[model samples]
Target: MSDIIRIQNLQKAYPGFALEGVTFSVPRGAVVGFIGENGAGKTTAIKCILGLVRPSGGGVEVFGKDAALLTAEERGRIGAVLGENCLPENLTAGQLDRVMRHIFPHWESETFASFLGRFSLPQGKKVADFSRGMHQKLALAVALSHGADVLVLDEPTAGLDPVARDEILELLYDFMQEERRSVLISSHIVTDLEKLCDYIAFIHNGKLLFFEEKDALYERYAVVHAPVEALQGLKDAVVAARRGEFGASALVRRDKLPAGTSAERAGIEEIMLYFIKGERI
Candidate 1:
């Protein structure tokens, strides 16, 4: 697959957490979810990619060209919606629209206006008067209006109601139908990603845990239940622990479970919970 964004041995240092040797490639036209717990370096990794924070080591390439060296013209192709609203609350939605339209050379005025109707954002109201969810939709509208090739979103679904979240995810799914557009979404909403992502990359404790295809995640990953005595000798399962009064259960790869063992298919939430609540990192 052609890579839209490639990170090679990426490293970033923090006072407490350090992103160490992280590497991943976001294939062109695919929606890849960057999953991790709070403070697990998801935003830090994204900031590095967006140049909001400089990496202490390694490289970032956008469209096969070094991101750090990209001119403003080259950088304009990438659009982002950060975790927080950076909009001027005093500005009316119309004013905000004008600002964004001016900033993005390819800005689609009709598309942006249509999204206002689609999102039901009031044009006359100041952003400060709008609820949290409204602002998020507005930010998304701005990102989509730019006619960007890549959408790099950070926690874009955090505040939306379930219906709105579904709508936004559906929009992403449709957006990629053009075969030249792509998205790199970092969200704690794993369930949403499970429904929308073509690829998944799990990051935790400032490190990468796993990177694989969505279908493989469901097919190869499994949750196994077994007795403590049985788990004691098990070497294939990374997750195994005694729980309650029943002994032990485990999260294992389907192919690696012991003889006679039958494990259930694991979903994204189950896989994430196994990583966080179980014995694994």
Candidate 2:
């Protein structure tokens, strides 16, 4: 599939923080998860992709054109949910739909109304009176209501409860059934991403660490629990290790480990923790 969004050597500099040479692409019909600790520049990178923030260097491309120079028609094909409270606070849901009709070229009132009903949002109430979770739901409703080919979401499920989150995930899954839609989402919630994403992109300390197929990543990396003596022969294989009183647990590359070296599959969060907090060999 062709790339729907391409970020090449993307760079941004801020006082005491910098996003340096991060590169990744979201293929058409693919859901890509962006993962990182707080202040790791995921949001900054996203902003640059949407042309909401000017990059200090490098560039972003969407639908084969420079993101910053996308025409209104091209822009209308992309939907974004940036934060929990991103919508206008004083507007009622019904009023916002009227406003959005003027904004999005293909805004659908019936679709928006259905989403509001599905999300249990009140059409009569002003947005300022809604809870944080309600804000997220409303933002998502608006995003999906507009005919969008690509979705760029930053912390889209931040304030949602488990059931609501599951509902939203299901909605996204349904969206991808058309086989041409794509999503680029960043969230601290790793399990949600693990469940929904085809690819995972991890950034740490302003750098791109890895961008790989989710299943392939787990297949390549594993956690080995063994006695320290047994682990001694696998130093080269160990990317990160934790030594306990009785044994050592290490994150190892499956290909690098000796034949028959026992290791269990690692989850996305475990792999992330290994990279961020584990003792490197």
| lDDT of model 2, residue 179 | 94
lDDT of 2 by residue, 121-205 (tens): 9999999999877888889889899899999999998767887788878888988898999999999889999999999999999
Report the alpha-carbon TM-score of model 1 versus the true structure.
Answer: 0.94
RMSD each, Å: 1.9, 1.3
lDDT of 2 at 178: 86
Q: Which residue pairs come into collision in candidate 2?
A: none
Candidate 1 C-alpha lDDT tens digits along 172-270:
876788899889999988999988899998998988888888998887878767776666556566453435476667777777767777778888878
Report lDDT (CA) for all predictions.
0.83, 0.91
Each model's backbone clash number: 0, 0
